[model samples]
Target: MALKDKQTEKNKHFIASLEFALQGIRTVFKEERNMRTHSLMGVLAIIAGFIFRLTTVEWLWLLFVIFFVLIIEIINTAFENVVDMCTDFHFHPIGKKIKDMAAGAVLITACFSLIVGSIIFLPKIWQLFVTYFL
Candidate 1:
């Protein structure tokens, strides 16, 4: 009986935790410009995937890279917020380095995502252009 009660409590906690996570996502999307940009790119990717009729493997790769980029961006945003809080929004060399490093991480992930998108979309786009124009 005690074990069952514990399980029930855990289930309730999990649902509440999910709500908190969703709220965090909403907050980030609302407040973070980069997150909004990434989200727009992700939406475009999904639309292109449907238009191009991507294969299962290609879809998997597309989804993976999109989420990976978003995840990294979210982490970068979180890191920036924490650093700002810690530094009280003052300029410190270490704080600048921290923010720069976090930004670099987002840049690297964005570049990687762009490369993946090109690899997946360029061929299809070229084919479509040739089909229509030539």
Candidate 2:
């Protein structure tokens, strides 16, 4: 293909690739309860951030951590899926270990992100409630 033709082909398929990616997201969200919970938490965090009017840097950090947890959760799900596929739903110690590690990763990331969210938002939230009472 000519250079310009190749470029055109790539451009044409970009939207298709995005559609496929979105489809994956939809399927995961539909099938995974944890994903649904995380998405709800993410939305609530966004709402809280807006309510508090977090600074640009604070928003960046908050968003980074939020997205970090979510990305890890998605990876963990995919890892578990691959493990299950390999083990064919049978009882394998190694498969169990692999799945446990993936779950642990999600747990660790969620905890870390919770700390980050608290650090960034807790002070502001405390002030809001404290002032209302005072």
lDDT (CA) per prediction: 0.92, 0.89
- Deviation of model 2 at 114, angstroms: 0.5
After superposing candidate 2 on the true structure, give the runs of residues whose Cα lies further than 4 Å from its correct spot: 1-8
Cα lDDT tens digits, model 2, 1-134, are 77775545776699888999899888889888998898889889999999999999989988998888888888988988898899888979999998899999999999998998999988998898899997
Return the TM-score for each candidate structure.
Answer: 0.91, 0.88
In order of listing, the candidates' clash counts read 0, 0
Deviation (Å) of 38 in candidate 2:
0.6
lDDT of 1 by residue, 1-134 (tens): 67665555777799989999999899999999989999999999999999999999889989998999899988998988999999999998998998899999989989988999999999999999999999
Model 2 per-residue lDDT at 56: 98
Worst 10 residues of 1 by lDDT: 1-10
Task: Tell me the alpha-carbon RMSD of every candidate.
Answer: 3.5, 3.5
Cα deviation at 85, candidate 2, in Å, is 1.0
